[model samples]
Target: MAEENGAAQPQVKMQVLAQFIRDLSFENNVALKGLTGTEMQPEVQVGVNLDAKARSQPNTFEVNAKFKVTSVNKVNGDTLFLCELDYGGIFLIEGVPQEQLHPFLLIECPRLMFPYIRRIISDVTHDGGFPPLNIDNVDFLALYRQEIARRQAAAQAVAN
Candidate 1:
């Protein structure tokens, strides 16, 4: 909140200060053999993980989201290609309550950064000589809930 002309005001703000590719790897396993178009659909596996931690700077955090994709010939299980990407963004948040900080950092920040990461994955796969691999939308809320449950279960096991 700031005073404007001696009047009090309220303000809320959140912003992405920067975004970058922390790491990326693309493997065209059969490039030497060459990728000829195939009639049969290839099987694809994708995995994503997200993490966030406080930065040295005040009210700032670094968020990392990793996406890994692997494709193989369905019939023979031959390697087609593999891609791994680590995408990160820096966020600046203000006026948020202490109790809400964890959820804000984990869920909201990644939600804001996912589109760019998804686009990078699609572009890299397309440039690697296959059709654009479109990633499905992630349910961050569900993932957070699942992680919380897993931790609780692990704690119970350890106590018993």
Candidate 2:
């Protein structure tokens, strides 16, 4: 008997729609404090949430990767708007193979979101009365590979 993919039948194509910021809010330096030490202990808290919207046609979807960042003092309760940004992208991906789509979603989609995310972070930090926060470029490709490897290792270990 043929393997039943059922509702999970793999689609040969995929695509992204216009990934724009649906909503965003930023709070700058809430509290100010004098520095005790020249070395600042910057603590960054990053939260990421994933969302997907299906298009009218099958295999087409828009993905949003939202990132929220809050920086605070390690010793004191001082707050800093290091960065907070919601970035999204609409990708036109179709007629592509399934194996290829994984990387596209994980890497390519995030890549598209990066610029907007960076901008929001920089502006928010600057407006908060601090130097702009320059976030480094992210390598989604490498990350995707690493994640895949880790998952495979875990599965192998479980089987053994």
Candidate 3:
């Protein structure tokens, strides 16, 4: 049976739908080092955080996928560059399968967001005078698993 509303209501079916970084950017501040030949064995630290938000309008959602990249020289511990990207997208999802939603939200969404994030990071690094740092392809499934494991471990520890 269809609702009285003119808009056709889709049958609730399970399907995976995802959106990812259509773009990405990186800003390397160590551009001068390449030209100056300043040798620095830097330690790199990378972190990522994923978040979701509901839009004011109906059936609209926003996902924020963030990556933090920091480089520091091990010798003197001088910070070389700190890059943070808040990449996100707004999507409309309805009638998607429950089984597929996790992949859609975790994997697909990040993939769509990646390109924009990559561009941003590259531009920032180039403008900062460092060689462009192109991020490698991310395995969202693996990342999601790791995140879940970490969270579960933390929760368990807290409970204990």
lDDT of each: 0.85, 0.67, 0.70
lDDT of 1 by residue, 1-160 (tens): 2475786543547999999999999998768556566544588898878888889999998989888899888877877899999999999988777778887877888899889988998999899887898888888888778888998999999999
C-alpha TM-score for every candidate: 0.84, 0.64, 0.70
Q: Go through the candidates in order and give the C-alpha RMSD of each one to the true structure.
A: 4.4, 7.3, 6.8
Ranking by TM-score: 1, 3, 2
> Model 3 — TM-score against the truth?
0.70
**lDDT, candidate 2, residue 57?**
65
Error of 1 at 13 (Å): 1.8
Model 2 per-residue lDDT tens digits across residues 118-140: 88777777777777776677666
- Alpha carbon deviation, residue 5, candidate 3 (Å): 29
RMSD of 2: 7.3
What's the lDDT of the predicted structure labeled candidate 3?
0.70
2 or 3, greater by lDDT: 3
What is the Cα root-mean-square deviation between model 3 and the actual structure?
A: 6.8
* Cα error, candidate 3, residue 114 (Å): 0.4
